[model samples]
Target: MTTKTRAAEIDALLKELYPRAEIALRFESDFQLLVAVILSAQTTDVSVNKVTPVLFDRFPDARALAGADPAEVEEIVHPTGFFRNKTKNIIGAAQRIVAEYDGRVPDTMEDLLTLPGVARKTANIVLYNAFGKAEGIAVDTHVFRLAHRLGYSSEKDANKVERDLMALFPREEWGALTYRLIEHGRAICDAKRPICGQCALADLCPSAFTVNGWREQA
Candidate 1:
């Protein structure tokens, strides 16, 4: 089958399996979502969610966060890992938002990229979840692993994998596709040991037959 056909099948099966797939990071506002995504780098959604309540309670908005003590921020977000760098970037991003965007998280991808610690993944997350925009696919570790294993892309880099997915899938499905693939990765196509035999997309997945209880066959 053609890549496009395979992509359609994958999308259909993923939708069936995860009709309610979404950004798992919990937040009440765009600013909170932006902060959560930034802290999510190199961390899990559960980890980010765990720390956000305390962090948000203390520094509720960009204006408040901008003036927050770095030590206090670090103390609150230390569980997310990379506490020091995350503190600096979140604080810096807050300062920029307060100064330039009137304390609002920028909606555009280019503008979002200007924030400290915001990359394409974080920018895409903010754009899609915060503003209902689809600038690009959010290629997190799950997406990166699944893209290659599913024969969607041979590229090792996240940006290149995202480009390959963009070429195969329609623009409208970009955001949803990202979350579905992430869910699939977490549920079945795990990096260490994929439960391919029980995977919903096993029929369409190239690596499915090769995966056993432990890992993908060489």
Candidate 2:
């Protein structure tokens, strides 16, 4: 079958497997969501969630965080790893939001990109989840690996992989596709050890049960 046809099949199966897939990050507002997504870099949602409660309580919004002392922020977010850089990025982003957008998180991809530490990946998630926009796909590690394993893309770089995926999948499915692939990755398509036996896309996946597919069992 063609790439588009195969991609559609993969997406359909993923929807069946993860019928209620949504952003795992817990946040009550757009600014909170944006902060959570930024902290989520190089960290798991669980870890981000653990720290966000205290962080949000202390610095609840863009205006609040924009003036937050880095030292205090660092103490709260230290558990998420890269505490120093994450602290700086998030603070810088909040400052920009406050200074430019008047304390509101901008919805446009272009405007989001202008914020510190806000890349295409972060911008894509914020746009999709917070504002319900679909400017592009968010190609996280899971999406990158799954794209290659499923023969959707051969690009090594994330931006290139995202471009390839954008071409293959429908725009409407772009946002949810990231989370679905991530769910499948965590559930059965692990990086070091994949459980191909339980994988729904095993038959169609080019890398299924291949050299990189199996993990040593205990």
Candidate 3:
């Protein structure tokens, strides 16, 4: 089959596996979501979720976060790891949002990039989830790993992998597809040891029972 055909099959399988694929990180507002995503880097969604309640309660919005005490922010976000840097980026991002965007999280990719710690991955998450715009697929660690293992892309770089996926899947499925891939990664196609036997996509996955010494493990 052609790459497009294979990609379509993978997409279908993922949709079946995750009928209600959604963002796991909980947030009520755009700014809150942006802050949550920033804290999510190098950390789990569960970890970010745990600290956000206190963080948001302390600094409710852009205006509040912009003037938040760095020490206080660090203490709250300490569980997410990289507390010092994340505190800096989250506060800096809030300051920029309040000053430049009139206290609203920038909806466009270009405007969102202006904020600190807002890279394509984080920007894509905020844009798609907050603004309902699918500018590009959010290639996080799970997406990156699954994209390569599924024969979607051989490129090691996340951007390149995202480009390959964008080319494979239609634009409309970009955001939903990303969430499904991430969920699948967590459920079955893990980094160290994928449970090929229980995986729904095992038959279609190029690396199934082959990659990462699955044959020996299985």
Candidate 4:
């Protein structure tokens, strides 16, 4: 099958496997979602979620977080790892949003990128989830791993992998595909010990049954 057809088939199976797939981060507003996404860098969504309830409770909005003391914010977000930098970025981002964006998370990728700690991956997630705009795909660790394993792209850069995926899937499906791929990665296609035998896409996956040899010891 052609790459496009193969990609569609993979997406079809993923959509079925995770029909209700959604971003696992818990947030009630765009600002909160932005904070949660930044906090999620190199950290699990579950871990970020655990700290955000307390983080948001104290610094409820961009205006509030903009003026928060670094030490206090550090204490609250310490569990997410890289606390020092994460605190700095989130607080700086909040300050910028309040000072320039008028306390609202910028909807456009350009405007979003101007903020501290916001990159294309984070911008894509915020744009899609917060505003339902699919300008691009968010390539997290899972997406990067899955893209190569599934024969979608050979690029080492996440942005290049995202571009390859965008060429294959419809724009509207871009956001949804990310969630489903991440869900599949976390659920079955683990980086260390993928449960390939139970993966619904094993029949179609090029790397299937090849990388899970380490699972025998588990």
Candidate 5:
């Protein structure tokens, strides 16, 4: 299939399989989402969710978070792993949000990137979830793996994969597309062992049933 046709088919399959896919991070507001996203780096959503209630209770907004002690923040987020660095980034990001953005999370990618610890992925999450902007695809691990396995892109780097996906998909579907792929990856196309036989996109997936000699059946 052509790349465009493949993208469309994958898109349809993803929507059918994960119709309700949305942000997994538990947050009450944009600032909370930002902090949750930061803590989610290299950590599971379950872990982040476990710690964020107390963290958010202690520091409800950018102003409160900006004034919080780094040590206390680290202690609160310790369970998320990389607590020290995450604390620094969260506090630094909050400080920048208060100082520069008037205590509101910036919606645009460029402005969001100006905040400390705000990379393209985090910025994209905020823009898409918090502000309803669909600037480009957020190529996290799920999107990265699914894109290659579905024959959509072969780039190893997240940014390159993001770029390739942006070229392949419409701008409007970018946000939902990535979210659906993430849901699919978690539920079906797992990294270590994908449940290909039951996957809705198995027929379309280039890597589906390839492990365990199932490709021989193909």
Candidate 6:
């Protein structure tokens, strides 16, 4: 099938499978989301969720987090792994928000990336979920795998994959599309053993049902 046809099929399947996809990380405000997204790097959302409640309780807002001791923050987030670095990024991000953005998380991609540990993935999540802006695709591991499997993009690097996805999909769909792909990846198209037979997008997935499909299979 052509790329356009495959893209259309994948989009339709995603809408059907996850019509109301959303950010899995639990948070109340933009500031909270910004911190959660930062902590979420190289960590599971489940682990991040477990840590954030305690962390947020101790340091509820930007000002509170900004004033927090790095060691204490690290202790609280230890279970998430890379606690020291996560703490540094969280505190540094909060401090920047307080100092420059007046304690408000910036809604734009350019401004969001100014904070430490805020890469394109984190920025995309914050901008799309927190600010309702669709500046780019959030190409997490799930997105990276699914996009290639479904023949939406041929790029191996996340940044290139994100760029290709942003170019292929409509701007309005970009925000929710990544979330849906993530959900699908977790539930069906897993990295080790994707349930391709049960996958809604199997028909369009070029990598479906193959041993070495979409990168080396475990």
**Candidate 5, residue 177: lDDT:** 88
What is the overall TM-score of model 2 with all chains considered together? 0.95
Evaluation by lDDT, superior candidate among 1 and 4 = 4
Task: Provide the global lDDT of candidate 1 against the true structure.
Answer: 0.91
| lDDT of candidate 5 over 93-158, digit per residue (tens) | 999999999999988999998887889999999999999999888888888998888888888889
For candidate 2, list the clashing residue pairs, or say none: none
lDDT of 6 by residue, 90-185 (tens): 999999999999999998889998999999999999998888898899999899988887878888889999998887888898989999999998
lDDT of 3 by residue, 1-218 (tens): 88799889888988988999899998999999999999999999999999999999999899999999999999999999999999999999999998999999999999999999999999999999998999999999999999988999999888899899999999999989989999999999889878888887877877875776655676
RMSD of each: 2.1, 2.5, 1.5, 2.4, 1.2, 2.9
From the highest lDDT down, the ranking of the candidates is 3, 4, 1, 2, 5, 6
TM-scores, one per candidate: 0.96, 0.95, 0.96, 0.96, 0.96, 0.94
- Candidates 2 and 5: which is better by TM-score? 5
> Residue-wise lDDT of candidate 1 within 78-112, one digit each (tens)?
99999999999999999999999999998998899
Model 1: runs farther than 4 Å from truth?
Answer: 213-218
Instruction: Give the distance in Å from residue 180's predicted Cα in candidate 3 to where it truly belongs.
Output: 0.3
Is 5 or 6 the stronger prediction by lDDT?
A: 5
In candidate 3, position 90 carries an lDDT of: 98
Which 10 successive residues of model 2 have the least lDDT summed? 209-218
What would you estimate as the lDDT of candidate 2?
A: 0.90
- Evaluate candidate 5 by giving its C-alpha RMSD to the native, one decimal: 1.2
* Superposition error at 14 for model 2 (Å): 0.8
